[model samples]
Target: MHEWADFSVEEAGGRTTVVVTGPLLVSTIAYLDDDLRDLEGPVQFVDISAASPIDTVGAWVIYRFAAEHNAEVLGASEQAEVLLEAVEESASTADVAPRRGWFWQRVPAEVGAMVFELGRSMRRNLGFMGAIIAALLMLFRHPGRFRVRALVRQMELVGVTSLPIIGLMSFLVGIVIAQQGAIQLREFGAEIYTINLTGRISLRELGILMTAIMVAGRSGSAFAAQIGTMQLTEEIDAMRTIGVAPVEALVIPRVLAAMLMMPLLGFYAAVTAIIGGAVISQVQLGIPFLTFLSRIQEVVPVTDLWVGLVKAPVFGLIIALSGCYQGMQVRGNAEEVGLRTTRAVVQAIFMVIVLDAFFAVFFTEIGWG
Candidate 1:
């Protein structure tokens, strides 16, 4: 019948004692906060033995009042004492400030953390590479171990299915190059040189580079997503449990397929690009298809074609390995699969561009440029 969470004060010997009574629950505690804050003079003690069903919020309020007055909490029941102790512990922890170093001082720590992460990544990737190589060796020793059916299936998926899109993209790129080159060269009455420009650039660099980038975005991401999903479903673990090497059963087929098909795809892309350049030359520059072909034959060396073709397998290997590595790194659920897939594409594309730059420099130095 009485009000909950009401307090009474008694003054004695120049000190004050606050006695808290009634239910100290959320519903009643808010009304007591103002009363607690309004209490004046040095408080001797807070007696809460009469309080019923004290909760964390009520305990925290009483703790704060006692702390402000440097007053002891007396007459608390065992349960209320436990709640007060917990609140005190939490408050102590919350009051502690986190230590921080200056930005410049933390640079070394940040660099070290980055280096550690990079090293871990490299080690994991190298382990995956070693597994694939070991599997290959095993397959060579026992030819029956090869997954011929899987290999053929992946080839169709990674190569044949990709042709239309790759061809269309390369063709459009070639047309743009030819049209832009003609616009620039026409100023000097050298529009015919567009054929030479398109042929040389497409065969030597753009053809394979664009093809690899597209494959990295398409098949590479697919590889990561597929393997990542298998991992999420524990299928990879099941394969391991059954003594089936996942590298051989899953990774090798995809890697071998990509490597075998990349060169063919690059050649196809180059030819399509050349045809597109010829068409654009005829239509936009009035150079005639025969004249464009004749110029390409005379100006573009066979070594340029070989250069692009040779880079294809290496690019394919990088993309496949990057994808599979990221896939294997995936843990947890569907969101992790998506993140690893995105990382695979970005990493594969980055490596492709970096290798292309290195190839450019090496070729130039060796007179292959």
Candidate 2:
């Protein structure tokens, strides 16, 4: 069924009339545009009356032809006339959308957008920190408003439930460090220094760092998911309506729990790691386990233990704040809950690592290395 469009030029009284024939819809007139554009028609009028059931595409082609030849469109029915007029009006000189630029041009624009987003994120985080501080002040003024039960529950979740996994990770990491250190130091006939490497690294850095990473992955993600779900269900909105501050009811307890438990957890991880190091030293280096433990006391300073404890609470604060802030930012749909939860975990871990680096530099300068 070929109902393709066709046009015939007829000359009458020194005038050219293009008699358009066949169905004038898009599918029929597909090749008509090139034919119309290439046509040189100083001779005349476009007569579309002979055309059957003309659509916008046909109208546009005919209108373009008539305009190029300075001829009037004639013999058009009401429908064809309406379409011609509409097409004529829509061929605007103004740009509807900006055209894409070259790759070099796009790169700078993309970089600027990313920098702007980073700045906006920092400002929002700072504002959220202020809100948390203000909520703390409110709770301080009215001590009875504190939710002790929620705080206890969060403590158990973030600390007690997390213990076994944190212990296991630290243990494995200690074994690796001890075994690796012994192998390396054995070349120099200094294999006994494996105890020093294990004890000092675990106490000063690895224990707290690994614990923070785990907590960020676990508790931080949980905070974002829980709060984001609450936001989706309008539970947060309901609390606000009932004159309850979300920060006080939900955030404070989690923040407090993390802050209180992190130091204890970090110390526990360090001790567990030390035990692991002892196990490795006894097996590989032929040192007695009790002797390895006793050596750790002499080689590792009390200052290393203080360093881990000092950093724990600060890391906890950052992780909790990042999670709660991202959770509070969630909006629109159920998919937003997952997105925000992921962002919370990523942001917490990134900030934790960055701050850890800064602390390392600062503490080393202050002779706490």
Question: Among these predicted structures, which one has the highest lDDT?
Answer: 1
Give the TM-score of each candidate: 0.76, 0.74
Candidate 1 lDDT for residue 165: 100
Model 1 alpha-carbon miss at residue 10, Å: 16
Each model's Cα RMSD:
5.1, 6.0
| Model 2, span 1-369: residue lDDT tens | 878998888899998888888888988997667777777747578877788898888888888778888887778899998998899998766778988899999999999999999999889878988989999999999999999999999999999999999999999999998999999999999999999999999998999999999999999999999999999999999999999999999999999999999999999999899999899889999999999999999999999999999999999998888788889999999999999999999989998899899989989999998
Q: Model 2: residues >4 Å from true position, as ranges?
A: 1-99
Q: What shift in Å separates residue 221 of candidate 1 from its native position after superposition?
A: 1.3
Candidate 1 per-residue C-alpha lDDT over 240-348 given as tens digits, one digit per residue, 9 for 90 to 100: 9999999999899999999999999998998889889999999988888888887888999998998998899999999999898889888988999999999999999
List per-prediction Cα lDDT, in the order shown: 0.92, 0.91
Weakest 10 consecutive residues of candidate 1 by summed lDDT: 90-99
TM-score of decoy 2: 0.74
